[model samples]
Target: MAIEKIMGTETELGISAKDPRGFDPVSGSILLINAHRPIAEVKSIWDYTGENPLLDARGFEVSGERERPSQQDNRTINKLLRNGGRLYVDGAHPEYSTPECTNARDVVCYEKAGERIFELCLASANLSLPERQQIFIYKNNSDGKGNSYGHHENYLVDRRVPFDQIVQGLAPFLVTRLIFAGAGKVGVENGGERCDFQISQRADFFETFIGLDTMAKRPIINTRDEPHAD
Candidate 1:
């Protein structure tokens, strides 16, 4: 009898390197963040700062009274914004915890992944443009010692399509254990067989990795604009 060997294959989604889904850079609204594995490896930015200014800004910014977004838009962003998102981690970070993030103008906390690394959550008043781009470093060892990796990406999926279909197609891409868009920490695992090995370190899995990009400069629109009548 001949034995068939099943060798493991290494996938190159290149998530840790950069955003794979690719945004329009102008109209892409959905963005993927790895909140679990911030470049600095800091814990809970919301608690660390003791205030959430971005959240408070909603009343004054965007629209008065925090104009509730369309059900679809709200639902999509809610997943990414879950747990407060005050920490500024990756959504597809592979970690389960979301860092209890929050965004408010009055209660703002400018903190970073590393101790005194630098505040990175609110570079913009509208919760746009992260403050610290250095979080990709991953390690506080800045002197040749600077750990590698510090980037987050966002995808703008077309709302017309069903979320489940997207998940199914995307699953194959993630099966190899990629970071959604170039943000991985643990390269290799030391437990069980490779087949059973699952990616670890996701902060807000659904929200960060896969959510609406309404705030995107232009947004990655996947809807059909054939001028359909209601």
Candidate 2:
């Protein structure tokens, strides 16, 4: 049987207000996103009727609290762009999720579009702010203060594939692929380590071999299974 794949990218942009006395990432993110008027229409409510995050790929569901948010809570941060992408605030950072792409090349194009969207929003938002109250957004993850943001990718894999087989075959590739796939970083965190330059900014932060936590105890390969568009 041939396997079909659909892929997309999600990025949480690092944001900060330039004011030293008062810095608010949440507000900064809101301003940055709202600056793009079209994204302001991202107030659509998310349907979470059958969603499950704790469901593992191993045919067992874990017990955990999964609270669904109302339209108000979600509408404030989410914007569905005409290009089929999404722009919104996830926690304190501005996030952009590309629309479903059938292949890697299309994924790249949409992801680049997301960046241009952010840049346009930033420029517009800065025009409304005071000269000293500018906002800065970084493409890289981590703030060099033990805080880590995320740039996650999602792909559609065949559910027929065995979980063990997927992990076994994919894990090694993920680990070594950083040699060419990394975004590069200066210095290091997670253990006070110092480096002139590193291939991947996210490499030293993986404290656990296998886990679902993306912020605290980072994992090389996330096991949380979600059947997208199911």
Candidate 3:
């Protein structure tokens, strides 16, 4: 029998601050997440006891220091939502991850909810600041510069399937789906072809066919095997 496919989405929202002294995205992200009011009191902290991003699905562990933020910073940067979701800061962007869903409709519903949550957070965050230093958030994937953030999709697959076979099957679909599914961008970046506009905002940043790095040298099919569940 085939395993059931559980799906979810993780979006890293673009953050900016209207400050004359320039902006710090990390600080802005921290403020944005901290401004949201949870459905109930946040009694427990987010557990990171089992997360190991270096563990690759290709059957090997990469050498690197896993990011473990200080408890104080973690408390300030993370928010648990009532809709079984998470709001937090990922790198320089405020990110939200919807709870695992069994269908596409619920996934999209939760993703849209995340945007509204950010809007409320943005309003609350701006109230505490001067009019000139207010913060803003964008739902897009790129910053229009060389930097690109992520809007990752997750699907629970059968562990019995070969990893190589999975990549081979998914790569073609992922590459070609941009023709219809792309978000559409105004201009190009990363020194790729000079076009007035492009279908996908992230296509220029893809350099490798497969890898584990999300920030740089991004892969078409990432191999990070940190499943949040057992």
lDDT of 3 by residue, 1-230 (tens): 77777999999988777773778888888888888976676666777778898999999999999878788877888887778889998888899999999999999999999989988989999999998899878888888878898899999987788999999999999999999999999888888677999999998899999999988899999999998767
Pairs that collide, model 2: 42-79
1-230: candidate 2 lDDT, tens digit per residue: 67677889999888877774688888888878878877346445556677777877666778888857777766667777888888888888999999998899999999999999999999999999998899889998878777888888887877777878888898898888888888887887866656888888777788876766666787877777766666
Q: In model 3, which regions exceed 4 Å deviation?
A: none
lDDT (Cα atoms) of all candidates against the true structure: 0.28, 0.81, 0.88
Candidate 3, backbone clash total:
0
Candidate 1 lDDT over 1-230, as tens digits, reads 33222111111111122242442311212232322223444332222222222231112312123233455543333233222333222222211112322232212232232212212321122144333321222221011221212222223335465655766676566545454543333322223233322233331122233323322221122221221112
The TM-scores, one per candidate, come to 0.21, 0.90, 0.96
For model 3, the local distance difference test gives 0.88
Q: Give the best candidate by TM-score.
A: 3
The weakest ten consecutive residues by lDDT in model 3 span 37-46
